[model samples]
Target: MKPIMKISPCILLLLSSFASLTSALTLTVGDKTSVCAATSLIVDGVLDYYQGTTYGGTIGLFKDPYYWWEAGEAFGGMIDNWYFCENDTYEDLIYSALMNQRGSDKDYIPSNQSLTEGNDDQSFWGFAVLEAMERNFTNPPSDQPGWLALAQAVYNTIWARWDTANCGGGLRWQIFTWNKGYDYKNTISNASLFFIASRLARYTSNDTYAQTAEEVYDWLTETSGFVVSSNDTTNAYTVYDGAGISGNCSDLSTGEWTYNYGILMAGCAYMYNHTSDTKWETELEKYVNGISIFYNTSNNNIIYERQCQQSGSCTNDQRSFKSIFSRCLGQTAILAPQHQSDIMKVIEASAAGAAQSCSGGSDGHTCGLNWGYGGWDGWYGLGEQISALEIIQNTLVLQYDAPLTNETGGTSEGDTEAGLDTNDVTNVNEITVSQKDKVSAAIVTTVTLVTFLGLSVWMVL
Candidate 1:
């Protein structure tokens, strides 16, 4: 049965958002009340599509067509909304959702979703915890693992899959051997590991994390050739989809994405901030420039998925890419201030267009995918809500504080070995076995031995 959704009343909702969220979202850029109201409505749209499995859904995920990983991505954006908008209307729900999904291993790889998990899928939660850490979202109690530790847990386990044995070195798209894309070393997966490492290095002041980020960049540039465009006229280089190790990562998939360049840009910006290295600064500039391919000039520089959006063929997952990229673009701009004006020009235009697109769906505020299509593109879902919310909220990014570090006021705990003891070790290609199964095997072995001994004795008699 299709679950009937209800519109959340906006009484005493987010700041100055007393207006009902069931109406179209009208925004006045640079006005706090308007931005707050707009984000509040979009956030409501976000929750409307997600009841979480615990809230009476199927299999611990968001609404139909959304993968489990997108839940993490949506919450990560919600945390950003919490940071920028200062609305805790759904704080408890968000926190509980994150904690509940923090698998027994606390590595974002829950037993239910582990069968088809990918490196990028796992890293979505890693990105979420990293967002919590950077945003200083409410920390866990004293004895519980903190957000920083959880992010590291994801990093430790994910980086463990760095397959040096194939195509020199890189992370495969899928984690398990049986999953379909295990042989494909995709950019989003590798970029995720790099993004996490660079973010961690900045937070923990750890040179080791920075080194890993560098090695990841080196592998993509040298081994995979996915980082540098085959036909580069400018210093710009688009991050292609990725390559299969079947051809030694030489036969590139060549699908460019907003998140690929955006993730790399943010990671490089973090690297530049952490080390003050000009090389990282150079990389940052190139990546930021590379993102230009995603924006259409005729559409007044509004971003779109060049590979799929033109044909209106984007998947549910692809629909959410802009939100992640928008968040990262804001981070990159703030960290690399030289690019702030340029980045905001693009973001601000898209924000206005996105606001206009929110006048869709039954509630009249559900966001649409085609920001440049003038008004509503008629698309509405968790992905559109997330992409719109993040872009809208992040227009206020400059007014906020920069991401914190351990040397700064960050209070999140750390555990370098968080995932080391878990049963879901990435190196082990087999499915995880529980302790109960081990005990059952032992009992069966003992009973079989006794039966064999009795049969031998009877034959002897």
Candidate 2:
């Protein structure tokens, strides 16, 4: 038994609460069902699986993207593209734009040339053609494609100048940072881009693209430690080099940290799935375990308590939605199912913390004015919420149907585990997932409508 130490009134109150729950209080939503199980039934709308869009109506974050990126120079070029402007569907358009930006290169013309007309954001416009071609093998539409095409076109033009040396090397500015006219590359972002590109290759079955991504991955892992810069801590890559706040890069540490590792982990997992190489797994586990140090406590409470205090400076602190969401999103990168439940708990709890901070309750799926912008026009707070809900939906889809398999019939571990044991009666603490009840009801409604509309349209055909 631990001795009770005297402390501040607030600390005493908090401690008392901890003592009250001597038995680990399982958060039950009712009927002793697992939190994941309860959340499973609460899908508000259908998700566009290929893209992370919600049906019924998108929350604030996915609604409009261009406006969100316009505020920041870092993402300015990428957001202003034809795919984003032309496709009115909110979530998909933004996702498409992000994908194009992540995979962009110079001299690489998008097969979809028309996507970049009438766009004023010149920096990212040119890359559109190459990016679209690389991903979809389709050209831009005849319509007035706005920001998406223009941004992509610009990125491609810049990428062409990138130096691919020694198995794989990245540019200094344009390649990884999207900054124009400079030629410096950081190992972290380059690794991140490579990871995203590799996943795209796996999804699209483009061997050449996959090979390029693999080469890039090889270079980064072989030459660089987790630390991207010499000044960075041992074995850890700084998110950026320019600013102390970003660990290895610029001043804003929020942009660097665990989230980058998460992206890299997910990418490596996908690469491992396609290449059948254990190296990817080894790398993934390293990052997964490495980021754990930042956790506030052994129980994962520190992550919640610290929230968005990356590297001490809260440069872009107003909207914690993206930062928190990144942490939760990273949990799904692991290929093992055994760890799913534990990961889900952390993701769900983090999301709940976000909602609890903003709104009084955990059921905050609806978007409103208070939700601040991040990657898209809608509030990142909402994006955080959507991410959590989508995880639940994705898990269910995998459980009921063995989806997420590679073309070679190899089972991808992506969906192998259903975390949180939604049906487990003994493991409480899953009550948070129950907050999704209304969202699930909305999903049922949307499905019914879609079914009716599809049948009607089919009959006419």
Candidate 3:
């Protein structure tokens, strides 16, 4: 008869620890469900639902009724969630948002509001669509004048408006607005252009996109004076806010935000991957290091907008900044694996903190703005939910073993397994599992043999 084997107390304790660590590192199905529920709540509560004769869509301009730029940001977050979860529930909703909100022509105008010409705003929607194309979420098929076409159209619009007359060669903050700051050439707008150009360059294998990325980078660093070189070589370059009417790049606003650094970081990473240019590598490293300035000292790694986040006075625009930063940072990590460890440390820490801040609400879970505080601050909005969802999804992306394959069938080079393999039982204390299943079987067999030998000796005695 075969003898029964038993696991020792020591082995049991080791397995417990191993399981705990794995659970801590990996997101559970429950967590994903909660995040998805929160997303649905945000969409249902905040977005304006209008059913037209031709089509219907959800408007994300909850804060500013007419401002479709914010809608673009919300839509971007939704796309990220869709990619991470791979749920087709929001697929039609996304398509509706893009089709209904955009202009009739290929212009990609977000809304019909007059003087709504914020180049950055248009670029945000375009960039989101570009991401959709890359993820294979676009309806019309990426190859045949689909999301890629929309993204390129937006790029062309921005390219056409390039102001050599203003800050030398940077895009303006607003394309055509009676509002102030139209003349202001901010770092975000130009960095967005740089990011789009670099990504487009990679996707199309076109030299023009690469050249355009370089042009934007040079204009920001050298011409616009946004990038301030450090005295020490090891220290990465410092980027400042954009210039105003004076058009002097050196006349910086000095208000540092995470998204600005993140955009350029991603752009440089893509450029490096596409061109194998060491300069882009250097720039990527600089921006990665440059993001440290936004990290809260007391918090483990919760990023904050240095300008008003400390005082809890972050505006609607400021509230959504960290998510953008987090998304781009994840992209950079994928493009450049060498920096993954350090980048993951920051990302994991922030995710942990953000997850802790979710308090029960009408939707079961609503996240707040200040994750560093580790508690809900009595505020909730679409922007807050979007930011939390981004961080959570980014954490999943980082934790997953396999590269994420979106609906479109395209896969990233860094894709691997979905999560840690539990079958391989190695040393639980050290968490070293080399052929874990085989090792576990061996341990069980040896223990059973030892028990059987002890029983035989007792019987003989």
Candidate 4:
């Protein structure tokens, strides 16, 4: 009879930990698979086509037959999907679009013509590249420029063009003076800057980025009066559209856009992560509550832009707003896990509605602009596809417990630990031995056992 080998308590704990770690990477079965399928349909059917010119190495924008700015927005959405899905199939396409859209110095100038390309357009692409670097979708190359370096170059150009004389200290909507929207100092550009600065601060551990983020937030809320509390019963603090050049940067436009609030929420969340300041947390809560109050519909609880309520029609730009908002809200959830439940409630409802509305299309998965309504709104564009992809990706990340950075110094199956090196035993010892640590230790043991078994066979020879 074979004798049973006794397993130590330590070994049992380690094995348990290993099991948890392994399960974390495995995709959840039902909704995630459907979401991924929808994403593939959008990428293959809608976004892949060749235009007049190619820049980096591949064909034209992955999102074919769209405006330059919309192309940039779509590129961002696709990059986000790539990050969440952990695939690089779209990398060359993204690289080519970014290259074609860039200026001589990588300034992200989609077009040289005035009013066509603006700070917001450049910032969107820059934000996407920055996200790619943060998520490890792209890494910094030693021999050449990387995503981080390119993003910094774009930020430098934007800093050089900051309009201190006009709106105290904010970016103009357009880069050129002759452009049509040049006089409009919009919330999107400034909030994008704040988001970029906050992320750079976290990535590089630089206080200057934190300071810049704070400055942008202060200028928008205190100086420009773009941030206001809604007079309705919700009374949540909301970010409005920017003041025009005519008002001397005093009068704020009542136009409320989701991306403006979303960017600022993400910026605050990152600032909180970097500084551990409660002020940013307070701001985050305000934004989350504001989004809940204003964007969420009573009947379906799906997100919607208030300005488009009169007509079920949303502009090309507004079509992608909720996706951006969901992505940013997901970031906030990672930063403050306390808010994860609230954020998830909002995201899951929208994703469910989005998935349900994915019928009657030629592909049978083309989503619509209004997620609150039942049926497809007969609108099938790159923007709608991107929005659906974003919500789905955000839901996947949240449901799987995949935070971008592990704050607890614990082992996550598919996530990187933020504060400790996985290879260093000393750092591992410094961390408290939670269930996750036990699992991480089990991983270390498994590798060691493989090495020992290999050596033992060699010795037998």
Worst 10 residues of 1 by lDDT: 3-12
**Candidate 2, 339: how far from true, in Å?**
4.4
Residues 118-236 of candidate 3 have per-residue lDDT tens digits of: 76787778777777767766566333346666677667667766777666788778765443577688988899988888887777677887888889889888888788776675577
> How far out, in Å, is residue 345 in model 4?
0.6
Q: Give me the runs in candidate 1 sitting further than 4 Å from their true place.
A: 1-22, 53-55, 58-60, 229-233, 423-426, 433-461
Candidate 1 has a TM-score of 0.87
Candidate 1, RMSD to the unseen true structure: 11.9
Residue 300 of model 4 has an lDDT of: 59
Q: Write the per-residue lDDT of candidate 2 for residues 10-38, one digit (tens) a residue.
A: 53345445534442112232122343432
Model 1 lDDT at residue 262 = 90
Question: How much is the lDDT of residue 98 in candidate 1?
Answer: 81
- Pick by TM-score: which candidate is best? 1
Against the correct fold, how does model 2 do in TM-score?
Answer: 0.46
Evaluated at residue 310, the lDDT of candidate 2 is: 32
Q: Which ten residues in a row have the lowest lDDT in candidate 3?
A: 422-431
**lDDT by residue for model 1 (66-158), tens:** 778999899999898888888988788788888888887788888666556899999999999999998889998978899999999998888
Candidate achieving higher TM-score, 2 or 4: 4
All candidates in order of lDDT, best leading: 1, 3, 4, 2
